[model samples]
Target: MDVDARLRELGLELPEPMTPAGNYLPAKAAGDLLYLSGMGPIRPDGTLVAGKVGDGGLDLDTAREAARLTGLQMLAAMRAELGDLDRVRSVVKLFGMVNCRPGFTRTPAVIDGCSDLLVAVLGDRGRGARSAVGMAELPFDIAVEIEAVVQVAP
Candidate 1:
């Protein structure tokens, strides 16, 4: 399938790939696996959905949207690395972290926002192993941060 075409069909446009805020690269390739650094749900204007889940006015639904935004950022990074989304073979794994208030435990459901978006865009190729955890705080207090491992055409 033409992944880029699929994105268009879904009425989605790729955001600009984000530059690393630190010294690490956005993505690194090792054989078939492309490892993506932790990506935040940054909007086109470069604003983040900053807050803690279940606190500071952030809730599960909002945090879920943040996760979806992170998925978009992930794809943006992937395209920047491979030059095309069609180069992707499958999503392998995802490690999602949500910034939350104490006692928040619905992390998995929040990260599913990203998972669902991936499947909506990539079909079966989007299915993958995943883990979601809560964090006391994340860099910049972004609502969610996600790192991914993907398989790409070689």
Candidate 2:
């Protein structure tokens, strides 16, 4: 199955790439590898949903949803660069940061929001190792942040 159909199977819709907030580039490619910048859950409407998981404002489920949104944004950035998700060879690595209370123990679980979404969208090619961390804070105070390193076709 193709990328779009796969997304439909998972009931996901990828939005257009959101404009970069500042000077940073959306994504960069080196050799066969593409390094996607950390993407936050800034909806196209420009409103920001900012909070931390396990924190007072953002709870675990909301944080997980934010991570999933980040994954969607990551695909948007990739499509902006590579034209099609078919260029992706493999999702090599994913780095996730979740804002949480001091003793939050579900960091990895939260990041599964991204991981599971990627696989749902990209199929087996999206499966990859990942690291999820609890961060003190993040830009825009978003609930979660995610970056990815992926191999693309020649």
Candidate 3:
């Protein structure tokens, strides 16, 4: 099944590509791989998610949800670029960053937000190696940010 069909089955819909707020490209094609830049938890309405892990009144659960939303936004950007999600062969790498208090201890859980979504959306093929780390803050005060390395059909 293709991505459109899967979206139908999953009762999900892709959002419009999130407009880059700066000069950088949203995604870059490197041979058969697409490297997406770290992006915020952007909503379909074109606004970034607003919260900070263990800060700004956001707890771990809220932080994780933001990460999940970031993952979905990443997929939406990829789908727009490739025209189809099935073109994805393997998800090679994922990097997540969480904006949190100075000594928060939920990096792994925050990263799980993205990992779980990939498995749900692309099954085993979408699962990948990942790294999640905490930072003093993130761009736009986003609770989480995520980027992906996707192997695409030639």
TM-score of each model, paired residue for residue: 0.97, 0.93, 0.92
Q: Per-residue alpha-carbon lDDT of model 1 for 33-74, expressed as tens digits?
A: 999999999977889999988755598899899999999999
- Give per-residue CA lDDT, model 2, range 26-48, as digits (tens): 99999999999988886657556
Q: What is the full ranking by TM-score, best candidate first?
A: 1, 2, 3
How much does candidate 2 score in TM-score?
0.93
Task: Judging by lDDT, tell me the better candidate of 1 and 2.
Answer: 1
Which candidate leads the pack in TM-score? 1
Report every candidate's CA lDDT.
0.93, 0.86, 0.82
Which ranges in model 3 have alpha carbons more than 4 Å from their true place? none
The residue-by-residue lDDT of candidate 3 on 13-131, one tens digit each, is: 76777888799988999999999988888766766667666645688776777777787888888987888789999899999888888778889998897788778888887898898
> On lDDT, who's better, 1 or 3?
1
Question: On a 0 to 100 scale, what is the lDDT of residue 74 in model 1?
Answer: 96
Q: Provide the lowest-lDDT 10-residue window in model 1.
A: 51-60
Q: In candidate 1, residue 52 scores what lDDT?
A: 88
